[model samples]
Target: MFYMSSGNDIPIDPDGSSSPIPDIDLSSILGNTLLIGIAIVVIAAPVVGFMAWEPVEEGNVKVVKKWGAASGTVFEPGAHFINPVSQSTVSLSTRPQAYTMSSQQGDGNRENTDDAITVLTEDGLRVDIDITIRYRVDSAEAVNFYKNYRGTDAAEQRLIRPSIRSVLRTEAGRLPVTEIYTGEGQTKLKAAAQETLQQDFNEDGLILETVQIRNVNLPQEYAQSVEQKEITKQRKQQKENELEVEKLEADRKRIEAEGQAEANRILSESLDQNVLTEKYIEKLNETDTVYIPVGGEGYPQFVRNIEGGSGQNSGQNTAQSTNSGSTNQSAA
Candidate 1:
């Protein structure tokens, strides 16, 4: 028989001996329900605790927000606690990142070239220049940065490239083409770009590390013209040098010829005309053939014969006088 607290006796089995089975153990059932409830709470508490908030690591910052919306405060690397229900975090790197842009050559064709800034020279020439930039996010200001410019590192790349390009273009436009190609123009351009970029990024709480100029390209036709002009200038200089050397050599030869003529004239004057005539007569006597330029109607030919005959006689007379003096001395 099944019996309730107000039991009347409804027979559950015909062979009922009615042993009074301990009524339904109410304490045990209640204890089991309580244990199950505790287990559920234990498992759920940790999951909720972790989701509510997390910590930022070393050399990093967590940009926290109330779900989709940003919070003004940036959290530096270290332990932090947040509401498990309301906030989420985005991590940003504090280390510097490098961006390299390729350069082009003399031809207008760009090879491995990226977006570049065009600059004008003092002479109103246009030149394209490539740039490289290295930078990072300052962790202390990271939270403000996120609020101002939200997103990931990809967002940083987007923001920085455009900013650099803008600054470069502005600076390049202010410079003259001649200065960019030569002189201190390149240095000034780099400094100007750097200063502008740093100022803008700093205002936005971005850290600027380095800036570089990769390539500067001009028109092919202009390049060729410059080369030709340089070559012509060099050739003209070489010709001028050669002319100077030739002038010096000609002057030296003229001076030498004039000196020799002066010496001959002086010697002729020292000896007198008679001495020159006597020397000519002596030379004619010593040679088998005597020739002289005929001038004034046969006078030169007549003088030549007379000089030759007189020179021979005087030589014979002088030899005889010398021989006679020697013989007299020996007798004495």
Candidate 2:
């Protein structure tokens, strides 16, 4: 066996054999190790810093913090420097985003689950309302939003959804189920809900663009009932319209009858004895035979008769006589 001494020198064999060990300088080893370490750090620092760089995308902002304390600096869309050892950046989008709550799978902001909002009306009915809300973080208030909510998901989960639900519940509770299902009432509800959400979002550093109630899910039984009620209401309205038309028709007939009666009254009032006598004479000329009544004992006695070729002349004479008699009677 060969053993080497601590003092760099020769190796001594146990069987009296000897060999020389290579001379190595400790200072050179230490210096070389230090140089390599410095080179590695110089090369790695930029790479690490580059890797730590946070990008604030378009329509977004990044909140930078140092040592877990907000640095009070918000970075706009661009590459920003951050200390890898003591700083971090949280990116928040400022673009308008839509969040939908729906029972169906494909229609909402979240596609993985059913997030429909359920509320109770004044009539104690459960209504599932699918709504889409468009909103965004106010760019000016991004820091405040970051400090308070940290991220969009947190804000949506804690603030937006809850506020929407609260407002909807309160507003919906004020309306009966029937009213909620009606067109005018539903429009009012949507407007009210949007107004309430707008106020809430304004206070929370968010801009609410729109609130749309996409669908309403009523209980099966209630839906059927509503349908039946709607049908009945339409039928009643139709009947009322028919009655109104009938009333108008009756009024028109009454007006026409009144006008005809007035016309007849005027005609009758214009008919004096002279006019009646003229009309009687005109009728007499149309007849070739003349019958004159001579007695008034409930029996008519024919006094004179005229016919044939001299009928027209006789009729004309009779008319003149009749006219003279009517005039005398009037004078009397």
lDDT of all predictions: 0.69, 0.79
Model 2 TM-score, 2 decimals: 0.57
lDDT of 2: 0.79
> lDDT tens digits, residues 217-329, model 2?
89999899888988999999999999999999999999999999999999999987567655655776565554445334322222122222335555565566566556655
TM-score of each: 0.55, 0.57
What are the per-residue Cα lDDT tens digits for candidate 1 across 199-266? 87787667888887767777688878877988999999999999999999999999999999999999
Clash count list over all predictions? 5, 0
**TM-score of candidate 1 against the unseen true structure:** 0.55
Misplaced by over 4 Å in model 2 are 1-70, 75-91, 170-175, 183-200, 271-332
Q: What is the lDDT of residue 73 in candidate 2?
A: 85
